[model samples]
Target: MNRTPPSARTGNRRIRWPVVAGLSVVTAVITAVLGHQVPKSPSTSPTSAVPPQAPRGQHRDVPGEADGVVPDGVTVFDDAIPAVANLDPGLLKALRQAAKAAVNDGIEFGVNGGWRSAAYQNQLLRQAVATYGSEEEAARWVATAETSRHVSGDAVDIGRSDATAWLSEHGAGYGLCRIYRNEPWHYELRTDAIDHGCPRMYADPTQDPRMQQ
Candidate 1:
């Protein structure tokens, strides 16, 4: 006689469905919790918002409007070496006014070294270094771009050394002021302008890389 095997006969046996149902419910709860905790997208915050547009008429057709504007009396020195400087348009207007005022007061005012190339500045720096030795030593005698006011094009080396004292007394009326601590010669049209001196490197403004050097 052949005996019936229990394993072979267990094909239709029930799988405890309650245990499987409980596991499914637990998995659903875990998924819901994780979904709530984690952000769906990586870039969703107020701080990551896009920038706003610039106001109308604020942008000018100038090279360094981001830097500053050229004052009224000041003009670009378009020589073989280009000198593009920005002044306070108001200050420049004031310079003309001041020049008129100075004329009334018998003081002669003139502007020199408004905007300079980094090469010209470097040449001056080299001369200073040659005379003094070491940049630190030269800085005591001459201004670096970081300390030079000429980079902004707002600052100018006035005609006379005593111009600072005269400007200090009268510049605010024209929106101009001396920006440097040591360089009595340097003056800027804007009162709020930063006082960093001449840039270390000056690029030729006329050269266009697209035109083939």
Candidate 2:
């Protein structure tokens, strides 16, 4: 048997230990790199996974109440002659009740107009003056901005001849009355009309005391 030299054996041992240490160090480095990368990759996923929330006060289903416009023939706002949102609260409530009653009776009450913005009222006055050829003549058709009940949100223009006719007979019970004989479409809240019945219709808006202002 040949005897091994101690120096040679020691040299071999030293070479093996270094290789093992090097491999261990490489493994630790790979693990550290992977650990650092793993944290960053998951960070983005959590943020992206969060669901979006709806905006506050956004009514996705109803457009009329949300926008306050209630285009012609769309009557989602409380069955008002149009949308009742801008009308006086009391007046709107009365109109809703009256409209509901009308609906039950097989008449679909509608509003062609209700509650005018000051700008809109002014625009109507201007248009009326242009058509009628004078401010005096316009007053008979459209009230001054300051005196218009439509601007005050206490008035509405009922739509459809049948709706108007139904109201002529039954509206007094709801405290609604036609103010102008010439414009049967125009109606106003007169709670007194509920008890005493609507005051006799004026021959026209010009004859209305409220419009005299």
Candidate 3:
């Protein structure tokens, strides 16, 4: 048509499409420049997964070196204390030798308890709770982590309760020591005094006050 519509004739002119296109190009260029200036993630390098070897002249801690021996067995408890007769091979040898020495001295140092699994410890805790009403109450009568030497397979309870005193005096000479002060029945071979290919069995020896004796 030669004449414009009434709506278009009276209204102000609209922005041209070319201007909008130009503005879009400008916005895209600005965004690209800003993005280029942004930081990038650090690059990763290939690494070997193998463990490093220990340095030369370094010796690992082993049991029984204080008395010039190695552990002959380790304890693992499957059931009640009396039922625990078996021991770790290394621990068994040491026990046999110590027991022989004790027998010659007219003392009986029988194995009262040995190795124990987490399940066994849990059962013991449950039984204690049942009898004492609460874990805290049971702990007072029983040994807790600070007093537990059972976590290490080397610890054991020997003979009747009275034997604890004798063991305390003579056990270390045989490469054994009462580790926890609170647990009179707990004992472990002197691991720090020995040379093994591993670090000391105990991270903190002082945690067990009996070790000092």
Best by lDDT: 2
lDDT per residue (tens digit) for residues 27-102 in model 1:
9999999999997776657788877998888964333323322334433232222333244355456566666666
lDDT scores in order: 0.54, 0.78, 0.54
Q: Candidate 1 has what TM-score? A: 0.45
Steric overlap count per candidate: 11, 2, 14
Cα lDDT tens digits, model 2, 1-213, are 998999999999999998999999999999999898885545556557878798887853432433234466744155443336778888878777787888877877666777766666777788899999999888888887799887788888887888888889998998989988889888888999999999888887888787777
**TM, every model:** 0.45, 0.63, 0.44
RMSD of 3: 16.2
RMSD to true structure for each model, in Å: 18.0, 10.8, 16.2
Candidate 2, residue 78: the lDDT equals: 56
Which ten-residue region of model 3 has the weakest summed lDDT? 62-71
Point out the higher-scoring one by lDDT: 1 or 2.
2
Candidate 1, run of 10 with poorest lDDT: 202-211
